[model samples]
Target: MNAVTRIGQVGEKAVFRRHHRKPDGRSLFLYGFAKPDGVSLPEGNDPVAKGGELRWHPFRREWNVYAAHRQNRTFKPSSAEDPLAPSKPGGAVTEIPFETFEVAVFGNKFTSLHPEAPDPPEIPGVSSQPAVGACEVVVYTPEQTGSLYTVGQERRRLLLSAWNDRYEALFQQGCAFVMPFESRGEEVGVTLHHPHGQIYGFGEVPQVQRQMASAFDDGFSLERLLPQWSEYSVDEAGGVSAFCPPFARFPFEVWLTPRRRVPGPWDFSEEESDGFAHLLGEVTRRYDRFFGRDTAYMLTLHAAPKGCEQTFHFTAQFYPILRAPGRVKFLASVEQGTGVFTVDVMPEEAARTLRAQ
Candidate 1:
């Protein structure tokens, strides 16, 4: 079992406290806000000064968020001015005020959703609503650099535990669906160079996730999928598994799931947590070595909506963009226009390549 201690609060939102946790007997801290005291937080750069709003796309029949404010987000800054780093005693204050800490979680300064979003002006034939939800940044480490793969066993375990805690917390905070995803490298459009991930608590379920849940309703189970499309069998450790599915969009996309039905990261037992951490870390490490460099990738945790826990199996998917060394796979016409992804490499070949390495 792990222990969590509420340390202190940061910013005007005093209720957002810094939480400390002990995973594998090592200490880890999670914060709720960035920007040190006395220093004003950077304001967003939306020329229209529009807060986020959700508009329904008639053709897609899904909601899209309009967050024009994110344009001014901090781009790749020098190592000295890295915002995710812990603030030093006399040094320029960054996000975290502590001189040193382990894992940290803070609300995104350039948020896509808001707790108090203004109502959108009514447009004829358009269903518009306020983008009301939460967006959080989870800092993997106090160190400015390194991928989640290199964060070590204890740290990784801490991260998993923290994620579990967050899943429960965010749901309680009124999120219909909580998504934790990481976008790495400039190819993936990652603005921040800092090794961190974002967790968005969506007020409504995204269309893709809704489609996956619908698949489960149509009698698709892990047992059926595994027999039909199992790419990597090396994921059978601790009852959780990872495999490259038949319909992977990216070159080397992999899906991680539990052998038994589990709703989300919070539902994992102690041993299952350890297993998932190992499997996830191993997958990431292999991905980095696959291209002989840090490959640009997107990792997402897909869990059932709050009510559909028993029916849906929680899974994590990784989509590394690089099809070959120094080459990136760009999603052009077919993928962008029709929502249908045309991948060049077969799942079998991609799985074989990853397994070989």
Candidate 2:
């Protein structure tokens, strides 16, 4: 049995989604411009695994999660063994059972957290608890090649809408914080070559997010800060702005945010959504064109924690690790030890280079 929902519309095409449950009890959903064609869900023979636990970090005043199962996840598979690809008519079943799909989302098999996670083992003097949350993988397309930059405009818009849906769903399920992010290329330690991203729902807001909330409560305003770096702007349209911040930690770091503060992607107006998709594509294309190759980067969305929505500003930050075509800006001793980032290029110069692309 399947359940269908009307997601929204892009241009003249109406987007819809169909949900399925994998044999191991994982949830899967397929999204497309048209209704999905019926297909038999595959029955798998894998064992159901348990989730990990979180240990308190005394000094940092944070939690660290340990999921030992992740060490055995699929790594660098050949094209023939790409698990993210859609299953061929008579081929071996993959993570996605669909014969064809525009986009796919499913529960991560080696997730760090789970709703039914067992209680943590007792460690004499240490604080610990079950890591109860959610982790999901979002496949951008059926094709295994090409990055988000090459997915075309309409698909990117659909991707954004899908992310918005996930955010709302996860929050309703009791997550305190949700983050959608993409780790691309080997330099960024991406084990899969497929064009996909992941969404992590945390039981509590992490350290960085807590810091952002504190700064906002103390009167930090992105609207006031953005104007000081107008010369570093890359693109702005439909109430959104994409620019390299003057205090960039990476050489080619770029931050995209709506002109007016919003709690999260779900709060984006229709026009802001379109502009976001356009700017996301533009920033990535510029990175590839400027470096004369596919640049390795980490892309993340920063939104307010569930209860702190009114005080936080939403932003998408792109941190490309490449300082040059072949050189990487590794976080060495000074960076790791002192928490200070040392960059080799200035934000103005980086913006000038990207704009030329």
Candidate 3:
């Protein structure tokens, strides 16, 4: 069984949503400009996968999830076997049941975390607990081709709205930290070719988030930092600004944030959200245009923890892996071992090149 409902409007476009339960009991959500129709709920059952546990990393003071099951997850399947594609009416059933939709989000079949995760087993000298969290796949389109930048502005707005919905829903479900990130291209180890992103609802604030909160508490100001890097500013529109930080750790690293911080996407006013969607598309377009190809990069959203909203600033950081066209910047011993990144291109140079694009 399935149900479609109008979830209000994002800008001038009307957004409709539908909820479905896969045969294996995983959750699936469909969002589009129109109310989805002719939905087919397939019968039969698949084995439900188990979730993993989190272990304490004593030296790093962080939790690491151990999900051996993830080894069997789908990896670079052929176009015909793309599991993210919408299920055909009488053909093989995939994640989505409908033949078409603007954007689809579903519980990851090979998630590293789970809501019903079992308690961790006792291991001598290791502190462990249930990896009680959530992982989801946010499909940008049903076409299975093109990048998020090619999805166009209307779809991008819908995507941001979908993300906002998920962020709020996850927080209400007890997620301490909710992150929506995209790992694009093969260089970033993206297993799927589809234009999609993932959202991870961590049970606790991760190390970087904790550090960011501390930094903000110490009076580290984005307002001050923006002026210092004014020369590296790439684009600004609708209250959102994208710029390369002077201390950029990657070659073409760019960060996008609102002029004024507001905890997360959920707190964004209508204008801020619209501007964010537009600037996000612009930045990705510039990256592809500058490199003359689909650039591989890590796109991450950093928001305040559930209760520490006022103390944190929301930002989106894009770390493109390419130092130059057709060349990849690999994280070597110095970076992985010592957490010190050696950037090949200066922020000013990279910004100038991107601006020309």
Candidate 4:
């Protein structure tokens, strides 16, 4: 029978995973996409043919996995008399078909939907009429058998690592700005619980993205300093190191820095990608385990816009909103109308919880 591991002492996925210390140490976990309806793992290492695999979403640049939808994937505390709390027994894993796409450039321009967005939302940091503005999606895993948080760290990192492959190709095709934004689980407001979807593009920068770029005046250089920074903590193939600001904003949010400074996703090389695969797996799994496994999440990429290689730092920002069993910090008056945020739990506390896993 195909085997699946459960969370451990701390009730988190990390407890079940042992980080490797060699270049190939992270790849030690034998991960294969599981087939649906109690099917087994595929014969080869071919990711596309695996039953429980992850692939890219063409519309959004984010990744999706093939796993069974968990029973408590959604968040509707008021739905039933006793709703599913953050801590509960999740459903069995779901598996689905896996598909990956080659890199391509897409624009919001000239598409059938262009006239429809006739007026894109007037964001604060971007231009209303810019040279380019497009959006696309990428699905990572198709293993519909488990919640996104249930996948092993090795597999998770590999799935995230795919971005390096396509980002380089897409940037060449004229994509100036790309951000994979994602929301998971129905209870937490995710539309699909079936492992999938994210968005990106080649065009005018989103207002927020432009503002973030302006944070640095001296143009950065991924070419000059990326190699050393991509995976700061990992030199050996299977290192157990991770990177990020010691103080982060959210629980278990991790940034993969293979080289010292990557201007953006397009500049990441093979080393960065491999490190990302390992780290991402570690981070995602820990997030769910943080709030009683299978927690919902959202991750964002903070990188240099297509042309501004000199002005930005290519970093990822993972936003996992699940604070506890049944509570989330509501974005009330102070946060909604006004652009401010406050967290009840300190980021350090969140980090500690995650690291424990």
Candidate 5:
């Protein structure tokens, strides 16, 4: 059900997110124009989409008209067997000789959110919460590349570079917390074949973030988060670091810790960005090579606690999906009914397997 098959044929595919809402208010995303590769616009230009007219359907309450030049794709609710089980984890590992760094950088123009998605909310949190930060996405590719050989050092650079640039832009707009995230379909239960990532900027933190902060306190700051991973530290104050915990929910899951104690993505230095990107490539490439084919996983950025002091550490987690090749670990009553996550495979075992490759 990926866009690969949906492309070329044309018509229209609407991606519907029933629970997630935008500030302007809309529950549907109808995508039909399969955009060309290596595309990006200047500061003021938008990517070329299909369709002949640019309009919004009153009945549908969504963007309408315009025959997009890109492929068409429709979105359906992911059946974790329930309408509410929308938390999909994408942590696949593939190494398919991804597009060059330059091409990958511009490739993101195809995603639904343009660099010019209007002005972000001044504060963060859902409208239900009133004031807080904003969130967005950054797709990694047009094809699945979370698995072996698909993403390497060069591609990782582009990914991080795009993130770094976007972070700065958000900061200039009076942003306080910039949360960068990636939601490749494999982990998110996406039926499409497109590859992309996301970025979020906000002036305050969300509720879920406040909870994480209250639970752990150790002079936790964004900078210190990066270094935590590299040193595998139980305590630290700043720089770049990464760590794989023994209590990981998934065997291959990794937590990236930064050294500085900043609020969000904009805190990164140029060299730090490059270094982090390379390190990310190293870690993910191992996973991709280990999987041998495309892999499934999700990456989430945790930086700066919301509506509080910057005492929280910045950390990103890599959540992989798949109990084994051809055998997926589905969430039964245990996970669905309760939040208790059962790690079917041991963390050591997964790390060894990944390292061996």
Candidate 6:
């Protein structure tokens, strides 16, 4: 079956991919464009070509990227100069040159990793790599301002399809792990206010993801806990479930899982993809209702490594940082120092609030 609507080239190294979904009997457009552009890729900061370095932390036994060049990325621009928007008629060129498009994806001007780069200079005690990986931007809409939750069902479905395509493409390029996520609101330190998300294709598995893989290796079955572990089940359709886990670190955290075990987004059945999109939109709506306004949050997908699909269960987690309408939840000393999160509201209570909304 034909899945992608349109596939073409944008700027250098950028690929434009679009898809459509007929939801509620109406067709909607969702397009994604990927490219690499820099208003300021001054001499030494081009991570893709040079100076992209990764260092191994001996104590943590993990890899950390040292791309100081990302400090110069685009920050808070006026609506007229929104870089994520499509290039308007007779207007300053933005990342996308196309005038009107539903959705777009492109390479991030500032990325922690690079898709291709030379190996970093090795040290005696420290191991290092070239920080080679891919970071692409996914714009949800052409509108300058709006939350992803406010987008229509068809758009959300298209977004899911786009993500699946990216995951598949990135994996084929030899990325070990792929993460598609969003950071919303100023509190989350989102520099540009545009409605967009990002996908990071890592050459090596991240630490947190490594831990999840370890759990599966130890015979922990997330499938077994799916039926009973959720304190608040938000939506269960097409063998997919969205719920608030009892051990949630964030007050209003939600997890999405498929009833049947699947390795990654690429493994999702058509029915499961539709249901997943529906639940995603539903949960976002509930978040807005609970807060009585736009909610600042972070959304992330954790999938199994490229080769370890059968053992690991792919899941999506949404972390809304707002405790009240105007109040925000700040991770203080304890959360940062000890890595133990102390939540003010219980997951059960958070679920109740969401359900009521």
TM-scores, all models, native as reference: 0.86, 0.97, 0.96, 0.56, 0.55, 0.85
Whole-model lDDT values for every prediction = 0.75, 0.88, 0.87, 0.43, 0.46, 0.75
Q: Where is model 1 poorest over a 10-residue stretch in terms of lDDT?
A: 8-17
The model with the greatest TM-score is 2
lDDT per residue as tens, model 6, 1-357: 114434433222233454322222211223544322212111112223233688988877788888877778888999888987767667865765556666766666666777665676768877888888888788888888877667876667667767877888789989999999999888899999989999999998989999999899888876898778656777687789988888899988988889878887667887887778888778888888878877889999998987788799989999999876778999999899888999988888887788777
lDDT of 2 at 25: 88
Point out where model 3 deviates above 4 Å: 41-44
Ten contiguous residues with the weakest lDDT in model 3: 37-46
- Tens-digit lDDT string for candidate 5 (38-73): 211112233333113223334433332222433443
Model 3 lDDT, full chain set: 0.87
Please tell me which model should have the higher TM-score, number 2 or number 3.
2
Better of 5 and 6 by lDDT: 6
Decide which is better by TM-score, 2 or 5: 2
Question: Candidate 4 versus the native: TM-score?
Answer: 0.56
Model 1 lDDT per residue over 117-205, tens place = 67988999999999988787889888777887788766677677667667888899889999988999898898778889988988889
Cα shift from native, residue 205, model 3 (Å) = 0.7
Better of 1 and 2 by TM-score: 2
The TM-score of candidate 6 is 0.85
Highest lDDT model number: 2
Residue runs of model 5 more than 4 Å from their true location after superposition: 1-151, 171-177, 185-187, 202-204, 216-240, 259-265, 269-271, 305-309
**Model 6 off-target regions past 4 Å?**
1-51, 121-124
